[model samples]
Structures are given as C-alpha cells and as structure tokens.
Target: MSRRSSKIEFVGSQGVPLVARLDLPEGTPWAYAVFAPCFTCGKDWLAAARICRGLAERGIAVLSVDFTGIGESGGDFADSTFSSDVDDLVRAADHLRENFAAPSLLIGHSLGGAAVLAAAHRIPETAAVATIGAPAEPEHVVHTFGGRREEIERNGEAEVSLGGRVLHIRREFLDDISAQPQAERIRRLRHALLVLHSPSDETVGVENAQRILDAAGHPKSFVAIDGADHLLTDRADARYVATLLAAWAGRYARGSVPAGPA
Candidate 1:
C-alpha cells in the first residue's frame, strides 16, 4: 500500500490555527477518522504518529491533530480548557467533513479520550468512538499536576513541566474539567464505543476501562492492550491497536474491506 502524510492547518474552535497531520493512502479512502492525542503530547508523539500512519497504510485516512497550545498549534496553554479541547475536536471533524468525507470514527488517547466522548454529540456523522488508556472523567487529569495542583489552586495559574516542556496550567482549566459531565456523555454517546486500556498502564490505570464500559450503553466493548504501556510506545503494541481499530471501524464504513496489514 502506498501511504503518505501531509501537514494541514485549520481554524480551531477558539479561532486559532491548529495543525494536523493528515495521513492518507495512495488513492481515495473509503473512510476517514480523526485522532485526539494525549494531553500535552504533539501529533508526532510516537504513539500518535505510528497509529495514524498505520491506519493510513491500511486504507483508512487519519487526521491526527495537535490541539490548541500544543505541538504546532497556536494558543496559550494557560488559557485552554477541557471544554476548548472538546470544541477543537469538533472543529477537526468539521474540517474533514468540508474537505473530504466526514469521519466515521473518532479515536483518542489519555485525557483526549474524554474529549471525544464529549464531542461525539456535536459531530453527528461519527459512528464509532475508541479511546486508549483514557480516564473516565476529565477531572482525573488533576492528579497529574502533582504538587503544582496546589500552586494552580492557590495562585490561579502555574507553570508546569511535562515531557521536557514547561507549560502553564490555569485554575480555569481545573474548574472546567470539574464541570464536565463526562459520565453522562458516555452514557448518552450514541455511537459504538471501544475502550482500549493496558491492564498495566501506570498512568490512567485499567480500572478506568471498566468505568467507561459500565457507563456506556449497548455496542460498547473493552479490549485489554496486553503488555502495553500507557503511550503504546512499543511498535508492536501500537500496531496491534491500529489493526484492531481499522477492523472495528470497518464495520461502520459504507464500503471497504477491514483494513489489515499491508
């Protein structure tokens, strides 16, 4: 299979120019998908790049976005919130709908999983949603702030370091996450849902998988990303996730074989 990727930019919900990597197969794709990366991670993060490109090679075009203030996108981290993230996801889906085909599948990693669950309602064309090592609620991300959680709470905003990058975290972000009704969103999510979590994932924890599954309605499924890390840093593990996702999403696509390995 001939697969390629190109950088694309679009206006985000906040009107900032957000960057994305659109991975495409050689010819017209039967289906398309949008990917939301882990919090603070860029589009080229190992897991994001591999999984999107892997999907492209399998005949499914994938648009992997670097949300506001992250990666090549333009915005201030301290000013971004959970609600903005969800809006950005909807904007990404809008881009796909206007330029190519509406994405039939939506996938997320880490806190982004929560974003997709909440944004699905805004994108009516989305037929399926999948998340990798996602938290059941947006508020769960507060734990990652560690001692800085107090600093942000007391001062309203604080600069924090993540993955070797220093960024600002504002109190509004905390408050916004707390206000999100993620569980209710999952319960009402009309699309088929797939939850992929690593039983050994030290970051998000496996219990979250159960929490999401229990809240979601029919056509929900859970798959253990056995022996995988939170980021799916291992090539083998990411490949497995991509393979499974392409196959699962194929059932929703109008026409096309399940995208298997090239």
Candidate 2:
C-alpha cells in the first residue's frame, strides 16, 4: 500500500510550536504511534524517517516530532531539559488523542527513549513502548558533552558540538538529566517493552540495554542489532528495526492492558 505523509505543527511543553511529520498508511490505520528521535536528531533524520515510513507501510500511522529547540521546532536548546522532553511527549500524545486517536505505541531513540519510558505512565492509552540505543540513566548522555561539562558548570552554558552540529549545553540540562529517576520509571513501566541496541554501538554501550531490560518486568524483550551502529544509519538496519517493531507491536499495540496500575 502506498503511504501518505503530511506536515503538522503542535504546541509543545514550552508553549512553543513543534514541527512533526505524520506518515499514514493507505486507508484507515489499525493503530497510531509516536516516534521520538535521538538526542539532537530531528524528526527528519534519515533513520527516523525511514522507520516511520516502514511502520506506515505496515498499517500504523506514525507521528515523528522535532522536540523543542531542535530542527524546525521553536525554543532554546540550552533552556530545555529532560523533564521538558517527557512533557513534550505527553503533549504529542494529547494532540493525537484530540485530532486522531490516542497513541497506542511509543517509540524513542537514544535519550528520546529514556524520555518515553518516563512519560509512558502519564499516557494511559499507550500499550507498547520501544527504545533503541537508549541509556539506562538519563545522566549517561553527559558523556557526549565531553569537557564542555566544566565550561557549562562554570559559565552556566557552553556551545558544544554534537553530531557535527553546535548546541548550547547548560548546567540546568545536566541537573535535570541527573535528577531523573529513570530506573524507578522503568521498574514501574506498565506497557510492554522492546529494547533494541547494537553491541558495537560506541555511543551508548550494550550494557545500558541490559540494565534497562533487567529493570523492566514481563512482556519485555530485547533484540541485538549486532553490527548496526547506535544511529542505525544503514537503510537496512533501520528497515529491519521497523519491520521487527511492527511485528512485535502487533501483540500489544491494541487494547493490551497493563500488568498492574502504573
């Protein structure tokens, strides 16, 4: 079936307009999903776009969003925190619920993954959650900041290069990531989980996936992407992820109940 893609704009946690792309399958969708891209990676990233396209081809409509301060979204990157990212996820869900259908599946990449885990409990309609190259703790993202940590601490903010793009890193951002109780959130996550990570991923080690899997309860599963990098830059890798995700999500993405109250 041919898929259709459309641009969308919605208010984010900071009251700033967030830009997103909605990929819809031919005819009515069986389910709706939200995709949170990797840190500093926009909704238009190659991997994110391909994954959404893949899911849409399989009958699921997907909303791929650019969080505040990234891509086409309006906001200051330095001013945004992990907490706000989670809030943005909730806002995205609310937008879907109001205009289409509540998202039954939540998928995130890298730091975005951690955000979904923390936000899942708030979205009562979410029945399945998936993470790719996600860190077990939000603070784990600091490693990418390198020496800029000291500069941000001393100056309150510092411009750091990430994925070849310069971004303002702030002490508040560090504090927020550190303060997030991700382990606790994972333990209490009521949705079915699918954790995908590459053993060769240099950015986020495979150990992080193990920790997340350990913290999560039943109905959770993990897949090793093997030779794929953290970003799943290869088209094949991204498509494989989408295919497996659609299959796994089939069991839980519609009306699946939580094991218990979140």
Candidate 3:
C-alpha cells in the first residue's frame, strides 16, 4: 500500500461549517475524485477510507467529507435534507478546485451515489459517476422517517436510530427528499456511469441497480459483485471496486494533475 497524506478543512455551507478530509498522494499531483459515503457515514468509514486509499495509490487525489450531521461535521442531521447533502458536495468540489485540479470523478455510495448523479451536471469536469449499493430513488430513504412523521411535523424533529447510531430527523429534511425526482434526474444524467451492485445486497435491493441502469443512456456499464454485501467490507470486494474505477476513469478523466509544489 502506498502512503497517503491527509488534511482536514472546515468549510462553510448552509450557515454551518462542514469537516472534510482531503487525501492525496505525497509530493505528486494526480487526477482528483470527490467521494461521498452513505447516509450516516463519515469519511473515515471503512469503505470510504479504503476507496480513498485505493484511488490515491493510483495517483489520484480524493476529497472525502462528512455531511452536516454525520461524523465530525457540524449541524444537526435532522436539520439536513437530500438537497442539503448535495449542497455539501458542491462545497467540497469547489474547495478542491481551488487547491487541486478539477475533479475527474464523482463517486458516491448508497444515498451518496444518488447525490453524485444529481450533482454531475453542476460539476462539468467530472468524467464519470460511480455508485455502490445505491438506491434508485431519492425518496427511497423516506422509510427512515417511519412512525415519526407525526412527531417530526408536530414537534419539528424526531430522533431515530440507524445503523446502531441515533440521529435526529427534521421535517425539512423529509420534505426535501420527498420533493426530489431522483429517478428522472438519473435518467437524464449526461455522464458515463458505472453502476456497481451485489446480488446479495440486503440494504438496497439489487433491483435498484437495474432501475438506474435502465434509466441511464448509453456509455453506461453495470457490474455485479456476486457475493459482496452492500458495504463491500471484504478486502477482495473493495479492491475490485478500486480496480474497476481506475480502469473506467482512465478512459474519460481529464489530464493528470500538476506536480505538487517542488
């Protein structure tokens, strides 16, 4: 494994500051990628860091950030919505553009996958979009608001525990997600896309991958990681994702990064 240099930045967005990790190769400028983890996930999560390390090993820079309420970022998760999540992505991208080269790839996992799809057009330099165990619709996460819909509306917020972690869900967040037509946006996505899913994925059904694939236009590809779970926890599974991303990205990514300061 190659050594990676990492830094933390505090970015302002939606009236709050977000914490993000910028991971890059030492003393080298490489193609850059903006990677977003799943709901309630942080940049240091097992999958996110692994992907960053993998990309960096190939001379690619990766910016992995925690959203408003997740990880070390500020703001309340309950106060955040799908739209707000996209805002965070834009902020991260802009930050990288100023200090590093424009991003050549936009990678998201699960819900983050959906986000990258929505934000692709805004980040024109992106060569490709990739998703892992991503859902087909933005509203698909609405199920998380179950039983608390009334409370969130009546009290303005509801506490829900997911993945063994407790998070507050605000009505605004629910409204934003419900208003998004993710499937339609995905169909119109103009970038080359690689949809990766596992048949054994229990979190988001494998059918979601089909929905995304079917809706997408040409220059699209789908790969099934036969036995891997949604998170791609196994070393082999994560490595496979890295290999595939490197190969696909090479075809469309922009020029190599400028060499780091001598």
Candidate 4:
C-alpha cells in the first residue's frame, strides 16, 4: 500500500502552465483518475491531498491539478470562467493520455464536481464520474461574489474576498457560469454517475445532489456523508470518501482498461 507522488505541469486550455501532482501506487495502478478540487481551492489542499493519496493506496493513480490562475498555476484569475475550467479538465485528460494512460475516472469536489460533469463528454475514455458536494448548476458558486455580483456586472470586474483571499471577479466569468445548461449536461452524461453529499453541508445543500441524480439516467448512485462538512476537514471523513470512491469507480474502470503505469 505504499505510494509515490510527483509534481507535473501541463498547458491549460488557456495556454498557461498548470501545476499538478500525480499520486501513484507502489505497483501498476488498476485505473487512473483525474481529481478536481473545490472552487478556489488548490490541488494540495488538505482534503484533496488526502483523497488522492488514499485513492492511490487503494490502487487508483490520481492526477490532481490547479486550474488556470489558481494555486501555483500561471494565469489571471479574473479571466478564468466555468467553461474554461471544463476545457482545462479536458486538457488534463489529454496530458494523461499522451504521457501515461487515459484517465477512466473523473472525481470532483464542490464546484469541481459540476466542472467534471460538464467536461465528461470530451473525455471519451472516462467510464465513471463521481462528484463530492457538487452543485446542480455552475452558477451556484456565484453566491461567493456576494453583493459584488452587481458591481462586477456593472463595472466589468471587482475584487472579492473568497476563502480569505482577494480574487477578481469578472463579468465574463459570471455570464459563462450562468449560461451553463447544467440540467441538460447531467441528463446527457454518457458515463456512470456517483453523487456524494453531506446532509449538514452549509456551503452546498444536499438537495443539489438529489437534483443531479434526478437529471442523470440509470447507473447513477448517491451516498450521504452524514456529519461531514462541505470541505471534509476531518481526516477520517476524507479517507472514507476516498475509499468509497475507489471501490465504486473501480467497478466501472478496471474492466475497461489494462493495469499498467499511470
């Protein structure tokens, strides 16, 4: 159950270099996965790091990355949009396909869950998509903009405080997220879907998970996180999620792909 994690860099859809970490099992991985952390969160956040490492121990190699302008990546945060996040996720998959092996599982947390769902169709090799605390709509994250939504819409951009950091919010970012046909996207997803939500999550209500389930077709599943928070601050909560995710996603990916370096 030993693991090794290494740094990786890839060109995002916007042409900026994005930073990522690849967590690999001691031997050949049964399947490879892409992990997208929550909104405004980076790849190395405690929750994300724990999940990737735990999943790797469970035999799924994981590539977790920071989106354009976020974390250690190079770009202007104000310029990144919801659509761009989806494009970047596809770019991450492309990087995997060309360098190692194509990812068969896509895992996302919070708003990232929505991004993976939007990007799933572009990754034909992906067999399963699992979302943790995801919102049913991309625009659900706009609440963080608070009263600045009007200011940004009026002035084109405004700096707002999110997760204790001041990030610029642009009108384009707002328009792009709001324009997403999330319900249509969910209904059209071709891969198996798994939705995980915490009933007590204060950030994104559990109702969002139910909405995604309702929109998806058969082969969809849901799990309640019980007492966990949206960010899964507790080590046990994060590990439990990783274990369950690996168990579920393995069923869909292992049979479709050969075990090898990933």
Candidate 5:
C-alpha cells in the first residue's frame, strides 16, 4: 500500500518547537512508531526517510523527528545534552499519544539508538525497541569529537566539523554523555529489543551491538546488517532494515500474542 507523509511540529524537552515528519499508511495502521535520527542528523536524513517510508508501507505509521537544535527544530545544539535527547524522545512519544496513537515501537539510529534505549522506560506504552548502529554507552559518541575535546574542555565550547557541517561542541554535552546510566537502563528495560548492526560498519563498531545485546534481557534479538555502513546509506539496506523491523516488532507492538525468536 502507498503511504502519506506530512510535516509536523511538537514541543521538545526544552519547550521549543521541534519539526518532524509523520508517515502514515493508506489505511488504518496496525501500530505507530517513533524514529529518532542519528547524531547530528535530522529527520530527513536519507536513511530515516527511507525507513519511515518502508514501515508506513507495511501498515505502521512512523514519526521521524529532528531533535532540538538539529534539522528544523528550534534550539541550540550546543545547549542540548544526551539526557535532553532522551527527554525529547519522551516528549515525542507524548505528542504521538495526544494526537494519534501512543507509539508502540521506538526506533533509533546511531546515537539516536542509544537515546531510545535510555528513553524507553519513560514511555510505558512502548512495547518494542529497535536500534541501528547504536553504541552501548552514550560516551561512545565522544570519539567523534576527536581533537576538539581538549579545545572544548579548555574553552567551554568549540565548533567542530561533523558530516561536513560545523556544530558547537560543549563540555556539558561531553559530561552528560559520560554520566548517563545507559547500561543500568538496558538491564532493566521491560520492552523487547531488536539490535541491528552491520559487522563491517566503520563508524560504531559491531562490538557495541554485542554489548547492548548482552546487557538487555530476554525477548531480545540481534541481526547483522551484513554489508551496510553505519548510516545504512544504501537505499536497499535502509529498506531492508525497515521491513525486518516491522515484522519483528509485530509480535510485540501489534497487541498480538508475544512469540520468542525461532
């Protein structure tokens, strides 16, 4: 079935308007999901757009959001922290609950993936959680800061190049990531988990995925994306992830009887 896409605006953690895209199926959807984009990436990122489209085509309405200070969202990237990102996810889920349906599934890409893992407990309605190229801990993203860490530490903030765009990096952002209790959250997560990572991904190593799986409880499964990159830049790879995720989530998110992996 074909899908419809619409632009949406919702208040974020900091009470600023955050822009998003809602992809809906042609008919009533079996479930609703929230998709969080990669670090420093927006809702319209190629992978996010394609995955939302793919899920919508399979009868799931997907809402992909731009976190505060990124994409069309209103806020300063330098003022946001990893904890705020998790709060933003909660706000996004609240928006969904008020307007349409509560999100039964939460999907995140890269750092966004880690955010979902941390935020899942706050959204009691979430039945399934999925991560693509997510790190085991929030601090894993510090590697991207590279040489700028010293500069940010010494000067409070620094403008660094990320994905060809310059963004402000703050010492508070680094401290927040380092202080997150992500592992503790994962150990107690009540929702089912699906971890998708590419074995060859050069960005967030595959070992991160292993650590996440190890920390999560039962009803969790892992899928290696094989030849995909960290971003799942290839349209085919992104679509494959969406398709598999939709199917896997069906067992939990669709209000059907839960079934263990074969």
Candidate 6:
C-alpha cells in the first residue's frame, strides 16, 4: 500500500475516532481541500486515494477521511445516519480550520457528494463544491438497503449488503434517510459548484448530474467524465478527474493565489 503523507486521528461529534490522510505540497500556505467518499466506501478506496494524492501533489493540501461508522473509524455502520455523515464532514473541516488552514474546496463522490452539499452551507470557509457520480436524491441509497429495511425496523438492526460487502443498517439510520430530499438541499447551496458524471456510470446514471446542475445557482459548470464508472476504477479515469479538478479549481475566483506545488 502507498502510504499517505500525513495521517491524522480526529474525533467526530459522536465521539468516533475518524481516520484521515492529509497530503500537502511543501511550502504551500493555508490553501486546503476536503474529500468525502461514497457510501460504504472508505478513504483507501482506489480512485479516491489516487485523486486525493494527485490534488495534494499540486499546491493544495487535501484531506480524505473515513466517516464515523465506516472504515477505521470507531463506530458501528448500522447506527450511522446521513445527519451523522454531515456532522462528520463538519468535524473534519473544523479540524482543518483549527489545526491547519480553513479548507477552500469540498470534493465529494456519490453519497459523499450529497453530504458535502448539505455541509457546504455551514462551512463558511469553503469557496467551492464539486461532486462526481453523485445521486441527486438521498433516498436513492435506500434501493441498496432493500429486504433489510423492514428487518432493521423490526429488529432494531439488520445486516445488509453493499459494494460487495455486508453492513448493519439500523432503523434510526433509515429514518435519517427519510428526512429530506438531498437534491432540494443542494439546490439551495450558495457556493460555486462543479458536477462531473459519466454517461456510462451504471451505479449512478448521468441523469442525477443533470438534476444537480439544474438545481444549483449560476457559476456552476458540468463536465462529462468520459469512460468513468461510479468508482472511477481505472487509473486513467481517476487521473482525468484529478486533472480536470485542478484545472477547473484554478479558474475559481480564489484561483488567484500564487502557484504553490505540483
């Protein structure tokens, strides 16, 4: 495994010890970014780590973390809800603010994208938001939890499968998913936005990207990530995302900052 440059342990609002990796360009001052992974995925997931490292190699410091109940974080997956996920993101941003500099960018994949969209309003330090293969609606995730929903509600917990892995789903978690439409929340975001999606993405069809684009305000851009899947499994696809992100972000108003590291 390729080790990340900086590994940090931080506690979420729920007291979960979230694990994260930070990559920074030498001498880069203050500029920072935060990455949120998709549902049932962790910081070490293939394309995510590659993209994070690529962004970090550039002047921007990048942080990618495992949410409260996932990966190396200290919590049970069954007990986690979308609200908790947002809380975790806020905690990570706060960590960057208190220890390093405020994060200027928010990058999210799939469900992570929705979580970032929901968190953007609260994180005043974020100048821009980006999403790749994101579902416009939060309930879309429930399709993956089928057959287990009733059991979860009845038994208080149920073991469900996702991304070729089994996880526990709890009733409270389901209730959280039922609370609101993620697309509506995203439409209210005030920050500059970027939406990237591949027409070939089998997991999250391109339609979701269109919905997000339609809902967001101006200063938003859309790019088709040709030949990429929901996971961006191929190295070339992941690199493409990194390259496009660096270029697009460079055009942002904050792009005026002097070149740092690459």
Local distance difference test, each candidate: 0.88, 0.91, 0.82, 0.92, 0.91, 0.83
Candidate order by decreasing TM-score: 4, 5, 2, 1, 6, 3
Candidate 6 local lDDT, residue 44: 90
Tens-digit lDDT track of model 1 for 31-59? 78989999998799999999998888778
In the range 54-73, model 4's lDDT, one tens digit per residue, is: 99998888999899888899
- TM-score of predicted structure 5: 0.96
Q: Candidate 1, overall lDDT? A: 0.88
Model 6 per-residue lDDT at 89: 90
lDDT at residue 51 of model 3 (Cα atoms): 79
Task: Provide the global lDDT of candidate 2 against the true structure.
Answer: 0.91
| Maximum-TM-score candidate | 4
Question: Any runs in candidate 5 off by more than 4 Å, and if so which?
Answer: 256-262
Please rank every candidate by lDDT, starting with the best.
4, 5, 2, 1, 6, 3
Instruction: Encode model 3's per-residue lDDT on 63-100: one tens digit a residue.
Output: 99899878888877767788888888888888888877
Summarize candidate 6's per-residue lDDT along 1-262 as a digit string, tens digits: 1223778889987887899888776665336788999998999999888898777665667889898777788887766788998888999999998998778899999989888898898888778899999888876788877788789889988889898998878778878878866766777788889999999988888999999999888889999998887899999988889878877776662432444533
TM-score of 6: 0.93
Q: Which ranges of candidate 2 are over 4 A from the true structure?
A: 255-262
- Which of candidates 2 and 6 is the stronger one according to TM-score? 2
lDDT of 2 by residue, 145-166 (tens): 8999999989999999999999
Specify the highest-lDDT model's number. Answer: 4
lDDT, residue 56, candidate 6: 61
Off by over 4 Å in 1: 255-262
Evaluation by lDDT, superior candidate among 1 and 2 = 2
Q: Model 1 reaches what TM-score against the true structure?
A: 0.96
